[model samples]
Target: MIEQLQAFTDSLPPAVQWIVVIGLGVIPFVESYSGSVIGVLAGLPFFVAVPAAILGNVASMLFAVFAAHRLRGVVRGDRSEAELSPRRAKLKQRFERFGVAGVALLGPLALPSQITSAATVSFGASRNAVILWQTVSIIVWGAGCGALAALGASAVT
Candidate 1:
């Protein structure tokens, strides 16, 4: 599985690297695995993989946050518009109740990384706060996975 993933990443051209990074970063499972695979394929050390993955993940999170903000405007419509629709109100309420941790961790598991990050931001969570927690989570998870894959690769070789 690891070798196959590595080969796929390695086959991609340099121009495709950014695309892969963004695509994997926005998605859920791919964000969790693609960075490590790319690192191994590129002949980068595990330490490098961890940071690269974290950066990709962070970029995705920022994109989501911006999207969520834009969605809020769309949902709210004009200032002259009376009140939020039932669905919009419900979403706002849910986000308000769940708070940052809900979106930061559980959201990623349930939805795409971008959606999760954006939802958290749309709910009026501080951007810095969300970024801090999400970055930490991404780094920790990416590092652990990268380290494990590197160790396994070394053992097999």
Candidate 2:
């Protein structure tokens, strides 16, 4: 799937390719880290690819955070209806165990940042705090993954 994304991105003009990267970044599982790596593999520069992916991911995440802020009241109003599924239960447990920073940094390993971020906010975590930590994680993970992708691509060539 990522290889197909790479092929499709490579076929577009550079500006549109960035747009494609950003589009993929907005996807929950794709996110900035994999989006940046896909961009790098599609031949975009690391600087451009990483930032574009981060911008898209952050934009989508902000939307989710704000949406969660509004939905928190509704969700909270109905305790019985809001009972978590086992997956969400585990996510909530992780949030309890790790807090925002640890979850922000490591949550993607288990679930998309979107899911974790929303879950955190639903648990009454500060929106601004979650956004801040998510930004840091996005940058770190995107850059790290992009760098490794570049290195691997170079070695393969």
lDDT of 2 by residue, 11-118 (tens): 888888878888878999999999988889887888889999998999898888889988998767857636778887876776778899998999889888888788
The segments of candidate 1 whose C-alpha lies over 4 angstroms from its true place after superposition are 1-28, 41-43, 74-97
Model 1: per-residue Cα lDDT at residue 123 = 61
Per-residue error for 53 in candidate 1, Å, reads 1.9
Work out the TM-score per prediction: 0.65, 0.82
In candidate 2, which residue pairs clash? none
How many Å off is the CA of 98 in candidate 2? Answer: 0.8
TM-score, model 2 to reference: 0.82
